[model samples]
Target: MGVCTSQNVQEKIDNIEDDYLKLDFNRFSTYQKLENIANNIAKQQQVDTIFSSLIQRMIASGQGHILKILENIDNQKKLGFMTKLERLDFEFIDSLFHHCYKQNQIDAFQCNVIQSTNCQEQNFDLIKEHKVGIVFLCGGRSSRLSDKLLSDIGLPSKKCVIQIMMERLKKILMLSSENKEINDYPIAIVLSDQNQEKFQMYLKSQRDFGFQSINFILEKSLPVIDCKGQVVFEQETQAIMTPEGTGTIFLQINSFINKFPNMEYIHFLGLDNLVGLPLDPQMLNLISKQKADVLCKVIETNSILDDRIFYSNRQFKTMDEQDSNITENSYNSTQMLLNDLYLSVSFLNNLKYNHEKALKLNQRYHYIKRGSNIQFEKHIQDIIEVTDITILHQTEDYALLIDDPRKAVIQLSNVHKRYLKLEGTQEEDLVEITPQMSYCGEDLRKFENVSYPLII
Candidate 1:
């Protein structure tokens, strides 16, 4: 066969192997079952050789590991162990292991100081000229945010972050429009499995912020493994899975870009930054002037231990307090501009694997608990090591909700008061500036007698 669907290959395996239901692995008592399944697939003339080899590789490498983990456990107890991996999605695991087996190396570049400059365009002329899209890295799980949805975290005046983001975008579009026809900018939001449904419901309730087009992309999830390299599971049919790091953005880049004909660029941003986005023409123009494949916004930071610190001008290495490479300052702001034309699955995959290997060796892992399991994530910023990125320097002036939500409210209020030129305004004042009122606290002077804690 030239090519076969996963389902087709699965059916062929099922026809030849009697006991591998759903590839549960637990159903088979011996490693021989796995060997038989792989051998049968290879023996079939109708099955693709590539698929057969991949299946064989899976069996050859995974069988021993699987057996060693659940070695002495009884069959009933092993079944209860519940390693219900995605039955049909073996290719994903195969790709993952393939990366593990093959070391994709990134050459260290010569370290140099990244120059920063400013650009300003009141008309958003550059956005109108390019096939632009916005990506919100909103895949953060709500479990870490006080068990609340990221969209539901209320800002001052009970306005949620999602609402504010929508308002700001609407304002930008209106400001850019000349003929009164606001351009519908395509927005791609990367959401995680944990909060995707609830976030969708919230968006639906808000009528998708009155936008004509919005694309919700689920981030890729990785299986959780123990310290001993054994896969962990939560239930009989569900393995413990966590969202893959920001690197997954590449996995969906082509698909998201293809959604809009000739989509040229995408502005990747973090949703938790409450101050707002600088999606003006100047930023877009800067990228064009630099002729860069990527533009990353960084803020000056003197702390060597800050997790956001990106170091080594050539390698673009991320440093921790324990890492010997903490000789530099500055932090990745999670704000980036990318040319979609230069991005491809193969290129980014290699970058991702290389970056992840580096991260693992550096012990830059955050252990989060899910029931009885703990998992580590791969960060996407490591692409900085392999790509030429123009750095945009700016001061820290925003409230990031990645940590404490309560503090974010206080910080948000302080930033809001400063933006609105309200002196000595305390959090108790509850000042609310809707996105409709002002994109960045500029157009709010018209509203008079604004009551305390009310939307202006």
Candidate 2:
């Protein structure tokens, strides 16, 4: 009837509902628990190092599936999904499914949250008057990409792909800036944990690129845990190993924008997104012609078999590329999978659910906080007041999914494979900083093998 304070939280923890904790399934006997753990440990061998490496890959790919799951739940298809499930064997799927249920709890903990995407700057000039600020979320430890950002792609110019993507956005934002379409808009980049110092050093000493305001910030880190709740590796007293989720950036990046208050529009792009982004980075002036609440850049799903491929891209291109390139390194790139249809369902469902969970987390925070009874009830209303988002379908080509981390590593490997076949694969011209890079928009190549075909 009232809000739960920290004291209330302890009381509730001491006394959970008998029915709530009582799982209906009768398979949960003590014998069953021991048997399952034993079996899991035995099968753990079957899992191999490959599966451990695939965790992020699988998660990235599954994000699409997670989205499908969210949509079904929102539309009251839970029972239907249960009925449709006949021959599926999901080990942690149960955990993931349960985790989605607790998203509200997570949202509760993040109550003082508000997200902004566009600029409201008044000083409109000729050059940067139209230039928009775009921050790329590229700072993860991609063990698959073999730490591709600082390292070369083994191509002609040997520039890192992050540099490739940065150049692309630079040209796009500054396209008309020459004639003063926009002022010198700075492109901010969020960096990874281990590589923060490296990025800063490069910008100062060997800063090879010309993108202005090529600023960097370290991605938040937490801790790495094993099954027994033990740390996998000793963590630094100052730096934790576990980083915040992509969703957490809605809050983390705001600190960096303190000085640049005059910024108008901001593009929150995924880091290792080498394929391409919506709103051609060169066409920033037109990308926000209308100025909607949240302009999500979505790719046209090519067909039904691209989820695995999509997940790979999402993990490597966006998260891992920004983290560590070693995610793809040298091994375990070949045995990845991509099934497009199911994956598409997953992506949408994941976003919906992630949003939902964020809301729920806010609720849980209320239940666990030290608030007065009346204050706690008021917090519930806060949860309901959060705005649902709008999606803008980007009329463009190419789709990349980051839900699956392994496939992402593999995908980066594929990018390198493509470059290796070329004689002189220079970083995109914009990366090198010349007047011509901004003018040349004719080389954008389209494809026929696109697999996930769905409306965003």
Candidate 3:
């Protein structure tokens, strides 16, 4: 045999891992499967009070099975037989019970501490003190984007949304300037296994997006494949299962941080957010200043039906074939899904994190099953269980109709709306650059671009 080169070695490594990585859809350990259901119950309880109106409806209809399990658990202790195994089950389930049912009881005693921290409006500087960062849930199968990422959405200009956002970020916040970065200012994107080639092209063309040296790390995709070896998704009938959640972006961040010692905050953006206002420097600076740990984009929608699917704290063995058969929710304190939320929950390195512990947690599964049932057992809570959760509200966070420019939502089906202005044009000159002007790079000066989303 010829000597194996680095290319050959890597290909072999990938092939071997790919074979092992695709575990059977139903092959979880018995203990692990039980753990998933138990955790989801806790997730439901955690959000119950805040979203009681919607959650009450979810439990009544969506969670008929989980609710009965919790009811059975509620009565177990009163009967008085506490074997170690039985006690472990009760105790684990009870931990979720309290996370779900009892978090509301805090309302009764009502200390200002919880109130001060939860859904509270915060300034950027003030939020920095709270150590809020970002997690760009970027990993996805870019099936919508044509063979070339830049060609997706058929823009005459070949810029994909991520590149467009980066260009905007660079001008607004001076992000790509050799040393002109906010200390600890991190911008992370979770990548899917499918689009490495497309993303690599981006790295070649627009390397200034920062995080260049170590920006693109892989997120582990959950197991869920068809007989023909395709992954399944609810959105489309024959799609492949990529990384399960944008939440996994956090895990990739934690892995990358060991090298970048000074990094602090995170600004997590969806890779495919065209309406994302990444081009506005004013917006980027404002977000940095506001000190948001996790900034969520809110578009005003007329639909009255609940767009937010309230998750139950329980594990679901995927009896249905959607994106992934399994979903994870709540866990007892002992069996916490610590890293689940550590990926999404933003905080500073002021507190050293247990990377080893996180690795152990990643071995377990997370879920989103057959009938839109989601299990959120392990979450940002295991680490940042939010002694208080603050939702920052800012009217200043609005984007104007820049050219009335709009694109169809790529990730979600049939959803159409105006997006935040990634390609920022001043009102007087709110004109699209012709092919010639865009290619020349002279048109760059005409358009005022920024990284952060805070725009005037």
Per-residue CA lDDT of model 1 for 87-150, tens digit only, reads 3244544444344423333324331224453444343664565356677776864445313333
lDDT of 3 at 145: 33
Could you report the Cα RMSD, in angstroms, for every candidate shown? Answer: 11.2, 20.0, 20.1
Best by TM-score: 1
* Residue lDDT tens for model 3, 1-456: 787674664464344334333334355563353343334433533322323332233222222232333333433342231121121222323333334333433211111110011122223342233233334444553433324335444333444555655555444333234325543344555566666666677667765455434356665544343322222334222223444444344445666665544444444555443434432223334435444332233333333212122221222121121212112321111121111121223443422375654564343233323343222223332222222222122211222211222332221111111122234333322233332122122214422353321222
Of 2 and 3, the candidate ahead on TM-score is: 2
Candidate 2 lDDT over residue span 1-456, tens digit each: 876564653354233222223323446463344334323322322332323322222222232122123222423443343333222223333333334333434332121211122323322232254334566655554333326655664433455656656555555545445533332455566666656776777667645365345666555543332332222222121112433333345444455455455555555565444444322443243323433223343333435422121212222212111212234432222212211000011222243457665555342312111121100111112221232322223322222334443344334334432422322323331122122242333342333332221000
Cα error, residue 212 of model 1, in Å, equals 2.7
Candidate 2 ranges beyond 4 A from true positions: 1-127, 179-184, 208-214, 234-240, 277-287, 300-389, 394-396, 399-456
lDDT of each: 0.53, 0.36, 0.35
Q: Of the candidates shown, which would achieve the greatest lDDT relative to the real structure?
A: 1
